[model samples]
Target chain A: NAGVTQTPKFRVLKTGQSMTLLCAQDMNHEYMYWYRQDPGMGLRLIHYSVGEGTTAKGEVPDGYNVSRLKKQNFLLGLESAAPSQTSVYFCASSYWRGGPESTDTQYFGPGTRLTVL
Target chain B: AQSVAQPEDQVNVAEGNPLTVKCTYSVSGNPYLFWYVQYPNRGLQFLLKYITGDNLVKGSYGFEAEFNKSQTSFHLKKPSALVSDSALYFCAVRDDILTGGGNKLTFGTGTQLKVEL
Candidate 1:
Protein backbone atom coordinates (compact mmCIF):
# COMPACT_ATOMS: atom_id res chain seq x y z
CA ASN A 1 0.00 0.00 0.00
CA ALA A 2 1.11 3.50 -0.73
CA GLY A 3 -0.17 4.47 2.72
CA VAL A 4 -0.48 8.27 2.72
CA THR A 5 0.79 10.66 0.03
CA GLN A 6 0.90 14.48 -0.20
CA THR A 7 1.04 16.71 -3.25
CA PRO A 8 3.38 19.63 -4.01
CA LYS A 9 6.44 18.45 -2.16
CA PHE A 10 7.80 22.00 -2.20
CA ARG A 11 6.18 25.39 -2.72
CA VAL A 12 7.18 29.04 -2.47
CA LEU A 13 4.64 31.81 -2.27
CA LYS A 14 4.58 35.53 -1.67
CA THR A 15 2.58 36.89 1.24
CA GLY A 16 -1.19 36.79 0.76
CA GLN A 17 -1.00 34.08 -1.89
CA SER A 18 -3.37 31.14 -1.73
CA MET A 19 -2.86 27.42 -2.21
CA THR A 20 -4.31 24.03 -1.49
CA LEU A 21 -2.57 20.91 -0.27
CA LEU A 22 -3.93 17.51 -1.20
CA CYS A 23 -3.56 14.39 0.89
CA ALA A 24 -4.53 10.89 -0.19
CA GLN A 25 -4.44 7.68 1.78
CA ASP A 26 -4.99 4.12 0.60
CA MET A 27 -5.35 2.66 4.08
CA ASN A 28 -9.10 3.29 4.27
CA HIS A 29 -8.68 5.21 7.49
CA GLU A 30 -11.62 6.94 9.13
CA TYR A 31 -9.56 9.79 10.55
CA MET A 32 -7.32 12.32 8.82
CA TYR A 33 -5.18 15.13 10.20
CA TRP A 34 -2.96 18.00 9.08
CA TYR A 35 0.04 19.17 11.04
CA ARG A 36 2.80 21.71 10.62
CA GLN A 37 6.41 21.28 11.78
CA ASP A 38 8.72 24.12 12.65
CA PRO A 39 12.18 24.22 14.08
CA GLY A 40 12.10 23.73 17.88
CA MET A 41 8.32 23.35 17.77
CA GLY A 42 7.90 19.73 16.73
CA LEU A 43 4.54 19.22 15.03
CA ARG A 44 1.31 21.02 15.85
CA LEU A 45 -2.17 19.96 14.81
CA ILE A 46 -3.84 22.24 12.29
CA HIS A 47 -7.11 20.50 11.49
CA TYR A 48 -8.62 17.05 11.33
CA SER A 49 -11.57 15.11 9.96
CA VAL A 50 -13.29 12.21 11.61
CA GLY A 51 -14.74 10.94 8.38
CA GLU A 52 -15.78 12.12 4.96
CA GLY A 53 -17.68 15.38 5.02
CA THR A 54 -16.68 16.12 8.59
CA THR A 55 -14.07 18.53 9.86
CA ALA A 56 -12.97 20.07 13.14
CA LYS A 57 -10.52 22.67 14.41
CA GLY A 58 -7.27 21.58 15.95
CA GLU A 59 -4.66 23.26 18.09
CA VAL A 60 -3.41 25.59 15.33
CA PRO A 61 -6.26 26.05 12.87
CA ASP A 62 -5.99 29.74 12.18
CA GLY A 63 -5.01 30.67 8.61
CA TYR A 64 -5.89 27.16 7.51
CA ASN A 65 -9.03 25.35 6.47
CA VAL A 66 -9.67 21.72 5.77
CA SER A 67 -12.23 19.65 3.90
CA ARG A 68 -12.68 15.91 3.61
CA LEU A 69 -14.96 15.51 0.63
CA LYS A 70 -13.94 11.89 0.09
CA LYS A 71 -12.82 9.25 2.51
CA GLN A 72 -9.48 8.78 0.81
CA ASN A 73 -8.69 12.46 0.45
CA PHE A 74 -8.33 15.57 2.62
CA LEU A 75 -7.57 19.06 1.43
CA LEU A 76 -6.01 21.93 3.36
CA GLY A 77 -6.47 25.43 2.03
CA LEU A 78 -4.63 28.61 2.78
CA GLU A 79 -6.94 31.54 2.01
CA SER A 80 -4.09 34.03 2.38
CA ALA A 81 -0.69 32.82 3.31
CA ALA A 82 1.48 34.65 5.83
CA PRO A 83 5.12 34.39 6.74
CA SER A 84 4.14 32.70 9.99
CA GLN A 85 2.48 29.98 7.95
CA THR A 86 5.72 28.89 6.31
CA SER A 87 6.46 25.46 7.63
CA VAL A 88 6.66 21.80 6.70
CA TYR A 89 3.12 20.47 6.39
CA PHE A 90 2.30 16.84 6.94
CA CYS A 91 -0.82 14.75 6.34
CA ALA A 92 -1.63 11.69 8.35
CA SER A 93 -4.40 9.11 8.42
CA SER A 94 -5.50 6.54 10.95
CA TYR A 95 -8.25 4.10 11.70
CA TRP A 96 -10.55 4.89 14.62
CA ARG A 97 -10.94 2.46 17.46
CA GLY A 98 -13.30 2.94 20.35
CA GLY A 99 -12.95 2.28 24.09
CA PRO A 100 -10.00 2.65 26.40
CA GLU A 101 -8.27 -0.53 25.33
CA SER A 102 -8.29 0.33 21.66
CA THR A 103 -5.31 1.96 19.94
CA ASP A 104 -5.22 4.47 17.12
CA THR A 105 -1.92 4.81 15.28
CA GLN A 106 -1.36 7.44 12.61
CA TYR A 107 0.57 7.03 9.36
CA PHE A 108 2.20 10.16 7.96
CA GLY A 109 3.01 11.32 4.44
CA PRO A 110 6.30 12.63 3.06
CA GLY A 111 5.36 16.25 3.92
CA THR A 112 5.02 19.47 1.91
CA ARG A 113 7.63 22.15 2.50
CA LEU A 114 6.19 25.63 2.01
CA THR A 115 7.99 28.94 2.13
CA VAL A 116 6.26 32.29 2.32
CA LEU A 117 8.15 35.39 1.39
CA ALA B 1 -5.61 18.31 27.55
CA GLN B 2 -2.44 16.41 26.84
CA SER B 3 1.17 17.40 26.33
CA VAL B 4 4.57 15.83 25.71
CA ALA B 5 8.09 17.01 26.55
CA GLN B 6 11.45 16.06 25.10
CA PRO B 7 13.89 17.89 27.35
CA GLU B 8 16.95 17.22 25.22
CA ASP B 9 17.57 19.17 22.06
CA GLN B 10 20.01 16.57 20.78
CA VAL B 11 21.84 13.41 21.74
CA ASN B 12 25.19 12.17 20.49
CA VAL B 13 26.55 8.65 20.61
CA ALA B 14 29.35 6.83 18.87
CA GLU B 15 28.41 3.99 16.52
CA GLY B 16 27.98 0.62 18.31
CA ASN B 17 27.21 2.40 21.61
CA PRO B 18 23.90 2.52 23.37
CA LEU B 19 21.69 5.60 22.90
CA THR B 20 18.68 7.02 24.66
CA VAL B 21 16.08 9.68 23.99
CA LYS B 22 13.91 10.75 26.87
CA CYS B 23 10.23 11.64 26.78
CA THR B 24 7.58 12.51 29.34
CA TYR B 25 3.87 13.09 28.91
CA SER B 26 0.93 14.51 30.79
CA VAL B 27 -2.69 13.41 30.44
CA SER B 28 -5.77 13.04 32.59
CA GLY B 29 -6.21 9.35 32.06
CA ASN B 30 -4.50 6.32 30.68
CA PRO B 31 -1.98 7.42 28.08
CA TYR B 32 -1.22 5.97 24.68
CA LEU B 33 2.36 6.79 23.76
CA PHE B 34 4.21 6.61 20.48
CA TRP B 35 7.67 7.16 19.00
CA TYR B 36 8.34 8.42 15.48
CA VAL B 37 11.50 9.16 13.49
CA GLN B 38 12.06 11.73 10.76
CA TYR B 39 14.97 11.58 8.41
CA PRO B 40 16.16 14.76 6.77
CA ASN B 41 13.62 16.04 4.25
CA ARG B 42 11.24 13.21 5.13
CA GLY B 43 8.04 12.89 7.02
CA LEU B 44 7.67 11.22 10.38
CA GLN B 45 7.68 7.43 10.46
CA PHE B 46 6.09 5.37 13.19
CA LEU B 47 8.69 3.49 15.16
CA LEU B 48 6.71 2.11 18.09
CA LYS B 49 3.60 2.54 20.21
CA TYR B 50 2.55 1.66 23.73
CA ILE B 51 -1.12 0.93 24.30
CA THR B 52 -1.92 -1.88 26.71
CA GLY B 53 1.03 -4.18 26.89
CA ASP B 54 4.28 -4.90 28.62
CA ASN B 55 6.15 -1.84 29.74
CA LEU B 56 8.99 -2.60 27.38
CA VAL B 57 7.81 -2.53 23.75
CA LYS B 58 10.04 -3.33 20.83
CA GLY B 59 9.60 -1.65 17.51
CA SER B 60 11.04 -1.40 14.00
CA TYR B 61 14.80 -1.12 13.39
CA GLY B 62 15.63 -2.71 16.71
CA PHE B 63 14.41 0.23 18.76
CA GLU B 64 12.57 -0.22 22.04
CA ALA B 65 10.82 2.03 24.52
CA GLU B 66 10.16 1.59 28.21
CA PHE B 67 6.88 2.91 29.54
CA ASN B 68 7.05 4.05 33.12
CA LYS B 69 3.60 4.86 34.37
CA SER B 70 4.80 6.28 37.67
CA GLN B 71 7.10 8.74 35.97
CA THR B 72 4.76 9.34 33.05
CA SER B 73 7.69 8.68 30.78
CA PHE B 74 8.37 6.64 27.65
CA HIS B 75 12.03 6.67 26.75
CA LEU B 76 13.37 5.22 23.50
CA LYS B 77 16.51 3.12 23.62
CA LYS B 78 18.70 1.25 21.18
CA PRO B 79 21.32 -1.20 22.34
CA SER B 80 23.78 -0.60 19.51
CA ALA B 81 23.37 2.58 17.54
CA LEU B 82 24.28 2.94 13.87
CA VAL B 83 25.07 6.08 11.92
CA SER B 84 21.94 5.41 9.87
CA ASP B 85 19.95 5.82 13.08
CA SER B 86 20.78 9.50 13.21
CA ALA B 87 17.55 11.48 12.83
CA LEU B 88 14.97 13.56 14.63
CA TYR B 89 12.80 11.65 17.08
CA PHE B 90 9.37 12.66 18.26
CA CYS B 91 7.33 11.45 21.19
CA ALA B 92 3.57 11.75 21.22
CA VAL B 93 0.69 11.01 23.54
CA ARG B 94 -3.02 10.36 23.12
CA ASP B 95 -5.28 10.47 26.12
CA ASP B 96 -8.64 8.87 26.79
CA ILE B 97 -10.59 11.82 25.50
CA LEU B 98 -12.16 11.43 22.11
CA THR B 99 -12.39 14.44 19.86
CA GLY B 100 -13.49 14.90 16.27
CA GLY B 101 -14.39 11.19 16.11
CA GLY B 102 -10.97 10.00 17.26
CA ASN B 103 -8.16 10.58 19.72
CA LYS B 104 -5.86 13.54 19.15
CA LEU B 105 -2.17 13.32 19.82
CA THR B 106 0.16 15.94 21.31
CA PHE B 107 3.76 15.85 20.19
CA GLY B 108 6.94 17.01 21.87
CA THR B 109 9.65 19.19 20.38
CA GLY B 110 11.83 16.67 18.60
CA THR B 111 15.15 15.33 19.84
CA GLN B 112 17.90 15.07 17.29
CA LEU B 113 19.94 11.88 17.56
CA LYS B 114 23.45 11.89 16.16
CA VAL B 115 25.11 8.52 15.89
CA GLU B 116 28.72 9.10 14.93
CA LEU B 117 31.16 6.62 13.39
Candidate 2:
Protein backbone atom coordinates (compact mmCIF):
# COMPACT_ATOMS: atom_id res chain seq x y z
CA ASN A 1 0.00 0.00 0.00
CA ALA A 2 1.17 3.50 -0.72
CA GLY A 3 -0.10 4.49 2.72
CA VAL A 4 -0.24 8.31 2.83
CA THR A 5 1.25 10.43 0.05
CA GLN A 6 1.58 14.23 -0.28
CA THR A 7 1.97 16.10 -3.54
CA PRO A 8 4.56 18.77 -4.39
CA LYS A 9 6.94 17.66 -1.64
CA PHE A 10 8.55 21.09 -1.88
CA ARG A 11 7.07 24.41 -2.91
CA VAL A 12 7.92 28.09 -2.73
CA LEU A 13 5.42 30.93 -3.07
CA LYS A 14 5.48 34.68 -2.89
CA THR A 15 3.19 36.79 -0.75
CA GLY A 16 -0.46 36.65 -1.83
CA GLN A 17 0.13 33.52 -3.90
CA SER A 18 -2.38 30.74 -3.55
CA MET A 19 -1.77 27.00 -3.60
CA THR A 20 -3.24 23.72 -2.57
CA LEU A 21 -1.58 20.72 -0.94
CA LEU A 22 -2.98 17.30 -1.78
CA CYS A 23 -2.96 14.36 0.58
CA ALA A 24 -3.95 10.86 -0.44
CA GLN A 25 -4.18 7.64 1.49
CA ASP A 26 -4.80 4.11 0.28
CA MET A 27 -5.58 2.64 3.69
CA ASN A 28 -9.31 3.31 3.40
CA HIS A 29 -9.25 5.35 6.57
CA GLU A 30 -12.21 7.41 7.68
CA TYR A 31 -10.45 10.43 9.14
CA MET A 32 -7.82 12.76 7.71
CA TYR A 33 -5.90 15.68 9.26
CA TRP A 34 -3.59 18.48 8.22
CA TYR A 35 -0.78 19.62 10.53
CA ARG A 36 2.07 22.07 10.37
CA GLN A 37 5.46 21.43 11.95
CA ASP A 38 7.57 24.31 13.10
CA PRO A 39 10.86 24.43 14.96
CA GLY A 40 10.22 23.43 18.59
CA MET A 41 6.46 23.59 18.03
CA GLY A 42 5.97 19.91 17.27
CA LEU A 43 2.89 19.59 15.09
CA ARG A 44 -0.20 21.76 15.23
CA LEU A 45 -3.49 20.63 13.75
CA ILE A 46 -4.74 22.93 11.02
CA HIS A 47 -7.86 21.15 9.82
CA TYR A 48 -9.44 17.73 9.75
CA SER A 49 -12.14 15.67 8.12
CA VAL A 50 -14.03 12.86 9.77
CA GLY A 51 -15.04 11.43 6.41
CA GLU A 52 -15.84 12.44 2.88
CA GLY A 53 -17.90 15.65 2.59
CA THR A 54 -17.16 16.50 6.23
CA THR A 55 -14.60 18.99 7.42
CA ALA A 56 -13.82 20.68 10.75
CA LYS A 57 -11.58 23.40 12.09
CA GLY A 58 -8.59 22.46 14.17
CA GLU A 59 -6.31 24.29 16.58
CA VAL A 60 -4.67 26.45 13.91
CA PRO A 61 -7.33 26.78 11.23
CA ASP A 62 -6.56 30.35 10.31
CA GLY A 63 -5.11 31.03 6.86
CA TYR A 64 -6.16 27.58 5.70
CA ASN A 65 -9.11 25.71 4.34
CA VAL A 66 -9.70 22.02 3.79
CA SER A 67 -11.90 19.86 1.59
CA ARG A 68 -12.61 16.18 1.65
CA LEU A 69 -14.24 15.57 -1.70
CA LYS A 70 -13.34 11.86 -1.90
CA LYS A 71 -12.78 9.14 0.65
CA GLN A 72 -9.11 8.85 -0.17
CA ASN A 73 -8.20 12.49 -0.55
CA PHE A 74 -7.93 15.58 1.70
CA LEU A 75 -6.86 18.92 0.32
CA LEU A 76 -5.49 21.92 2.23
CA GLY A 77 -5.70 25.29 0.54
CA LEU A 78 -3.97 28.57 1.25
CA GLU A 79 -5.78 31.51 -0.32
CA SER A 80 -2.96 33.98 0.18
CA ALA A 81 0.32 32.52 1.38
CA ALA A 82 2.18 34.50 3.97
CA PRO A 83 5.68 34.23 5.40
CA SER A 84 4.21 32.93 8.63
CA GLN A 85 2.74 30.03 6.69
CA THR A 86 6.16 28.66 5.82
CA SER A 87 6.54 25.32 7.48
CA VAL A 88 6.57 21.59 6.92
CA TYR A 89 3.04 20.34 6.38
CA PHE A 90 2.05 16.81 7.22
CA CYS A 91 -1.05 14.79 6.44
CA ALA A 92 -2.38 11.99 8.61
CA SER A 93 -5.30 9.56 8.53
CA SER A 94 -6.85 7.03 10.83
CA TYR A 95 -9.80 4.67 11.09
CA TRP A 96 -12.26 5.46 13.84
CA ARG A 97 -14.21 2.84 15.74
CA GLY A 98 -15.62 4.79 18.66
CA GLY A 99 -14.01 7.00 21.29
CA PRO A 100 -10.36 7.38 22.24
CA GLU A 101 -10.49 3.95 23.79
CA SER A 102 -11.60 2.42 20.54
CA THR A 103 -8.87 3.65 18.20
CA ASP A 104 -6.10 6.24 18.36
CA THR A 105 -3.42 5.30 15.90
CA GLN A 106 -2.64 7.79 13.11
CA TYR A 107 -0.56 7.17 9.98
CA PHE A 108 1.27 10.15 8.52
CA GLY A 109 2.31 11.21 5.04
CA PRO A 110 5.81 12.10 3.83
CA GLY A 111 5.16 15.86 4.43
CA THR A 112 5.39 18.90 2.17
CA ARG A 113 7.84 21.75 2.75
CA LEU A 114 6.25 25.08 1.86
CA THR A 115 8.12 28.34 1.99
CA VAL A 116 6.28 31.61 1.51
CA LEU A 117 8.31 34.73 1.09
CA ALA B 1 -8.80 21.18 26.65
CA GLN B 2 -6.40 18.26 26.23
CA SER B 3 -2.70 18.98 26.00
CA VAL B 4 0.70 17.33 26.27
CA ALA B 5 4.07 18.53 27.48
CA GLN B 6 7.60 17.36 26.79
CA PRO B 7 9.60 19.15 29.47
CA GLU B 8 13.01 18.57 28.04
CA ASP B 9 13.85 20.40 24.86
CA GLN B 10 16.70 17.98 24.13
CA VAL B 11 17.97 14.75 25.65
CA ASN B 12 21.42 13.22 25.14
CA VAL B 13 22.29 9.64 25.91
CA ALA B 14 25.27 7.44 25.16
CA GLU B 15 24.73 4.47 22.88
CA GLY B 16 23.95 1.22 24.68
CA ASN B 17 22.56 3.11 27.67
CA PRO B 18 18.98 3.23 28.69
CA LEU B 19 17.11 6.26 27.40
CA THR B 20 14.05 8.02 28.67
CA VAL B 21 11.95 10.79 27.15
CA LYS B 22 9.50 12.42 29.48
CA CYS B 23 5.91 13.23 28.57
CA THR B 24 2.97 14.48 30.60
CA TYR B 25 -0.64 15.01 29.63
CA SER B 26 -3.69 16.82 30.92
CA VAL B 27 -7.25 15.76 30.19
CA SER B 28 -10.54 15.37 31.97
CA GLY B 29 -11.38 11.76 31.12
CA ASN B 30 -9.40 8.70 30.26
CA PRO B 31 -6.54 9.61 27.94
CA TYR B 32 -5.44 7.77 24.84
CA LEU B 33 -1.79 8.56 24.60
CA PHE B 34 0.61 8.17 21.65
CA TRP B 35 4.25 8.53 20.80
CA TYR B 36 5.63 9.53 17.41
CA VAL B 37 9.14 9.95 16.09
CA GLN B 38 10.33 12.10 13.21
CA TYR B 39 13.61 12.06 11.35
CA PRO B 40 15.05 14.91 9.38
CA ASN B 41 13.06 15.68 6.24
CA ARG B 42 10.58 12.90 7.01
CA GLY B 43 7.08 12.66 8.34
CA LEU B 44 6.23 11.59 11.85
CA GLN B 45 6.13 7.84 12.43
CA PHE B 46 3.91 6.14 14.93
CA LEU B 47 5.96 4.67 17.73
CA LEU B 48 3.36 3.31 20.11
CA LYS B 49 0.03 4.09 21.70
CA TYR B 50 -1.65 3.49 25.05
CA ILE B 51 -5.37 2.90 24.65
CA THR B 52 -6.15 0.74 27.65
CA GLY B 53 -5.08 -2.49 29.34
CA ASP B 54 -1.39 -2.72 30.10
CA ASN B 55 0.29 0.41 31.35
CA LEU B 56 3.50 -0.56 29.56
CA VAL B 57 2.97 -0.56 25.83
CA LYS B 58 5.68 -1.92 23.58
CA GLY B 59 6.01 -0.88 19.98
CA SER B 60 8.21 -0.87 16.86
CA TYR B 61 12.02 -0.42 16.88
CA GLY B 62 12.50 -1.62 20.43
CA PHE B 63 10.60 1.34 21.79
CA GLU B 64 8.07 1.33 24.58
CA ALA B 65 6.06 3.64 26.84
CA GLU B 66 4.66 3.43 30.31
CA PHE B 67 1.35 4.97 31.19
CA ASN B 68 1.20 6.43 34.68
CA LYS B 69 -2.31 7.41 35.48
CA SER B 70 -1.46 8.90 38.86
CA GLN B 71 1.14 11.17 37.37
CA THR B 72 -0.78 11.74 34.17
CA SER B 73 2.28 10.86 32.17
CA PHE B 74 3.19 8.57 29.27
CA HIS B 75 6.93 8.42 28.92
CA LEU B 76 8.77 6.76 26.04
CA LYS B 77 11.69 4.54 26.86
CA LYS B 78 14.20 2.20 25.23
CA PRO B 79 16.35 -0.38 26.98
CA SER B 80 19.37 0.43 24.92
CA ALA B 81 19.91 3.57 22.96
CA LEU B 82 21.42 3.57 19.48
CA VAL B 83 22.78 6.25 17.25
CA SER B 84 20.01 5.57 14.80
CA ASP B 85 17.46 6.31 17.48
CA SER B 86 18.27 10.01 17.47
CA ALA B 87 15.25 11.97 16.34
CA LEU B 88 12.47 14.31 17.42
CA TYR B 89 9.92 12.66 19.68
CA PHE B 90 6.38 13.87 20.26
CA CYS B 91 3.70 12.96 22.74
CA ALA B 92 0.04 13.25 21.83
CA VAL B 93 -3.27 12.73 23.56
CA ARG B 94 -6.73 12.11 22.20
CA ASP B 95 -9.57 13.69 24.15
CA ASP B 96 -12.76 12.11 22.89
CA ILE B 97 -15.14 13.69 25.37
CA LEU B 98 -13.94 17.24 24.73
CA THR B 99 -13.33 17.10 21.01
CA GLY B 100 -16.39 14.88 20.43
CA GLY B 101 -14.36 13.29 17.66
CA GLY B 102 -11.88 10.45 17.37
CA ASN B 103 -9.36 12.14 15.06
CA LYS B 104 -8.20 15.09 17.10
CA LEU B 105 -4.69 14.74 18.52
CA THR B 106 -3.03 17.39 20.66
CA PHE B 107 0.71 17.16 20.37
CA GLY B 108 3.43 18.39 22.69
CA THR B 109 6.22 20.81 21.88
CA GLY B 110 8.43 17.82 21.01
CA THR B 111 11.72 16.57 22.47
CA GLN B 112 14.85 16.07 20.47
CA LEU B 113 16.73 12.91 21.45
CA LYS B 114 20.33 12.44 20.52
CA VAL B 115 22.01 9.08 21.03
CA GLU B 116 25.76 9.20 20.80
CA LEU B 117 28.39 6.50 20.59
* Model 1 per-residue lDDT tens digits across residues A16-70: 9999999999999999999999999999999999899999998899999999999
Interface alpha-carbon RMSD, every candidate: 1.0, 1.4
RMSD in Å for all candidates? 1.1, 1.0
Pick the DockQ winner. Answer: 1
Please give the distance, in angstroms, between residue B46's alpha carbon in candidate 1 and its true position after superposition. 0.5
Position A110, candidate 2: lDDT = 94
Model 1 CA deviation exceeding 4 Å by range: B98-101
Model 1 native-contact share: 0.77
- Per residue, candidate 2 scores C-alpha lDDT tens digits across A34-72 of 999999888999999999999999889999999999999
TM-score of chain B of 1: 0.95
Colliding residue pairs in candidate 1: none
Q: B4-96 in candidate 2: lDDT tens per residue? A: 999999999999999999999998888889999999889999999988899999999999999999999999999999999999999998866
Model 2 off-target regions past 4 Å?
A: none
Position A88, candidate 2: lDDT: 96
The DockQ-derived docking category for candidate 1 is high
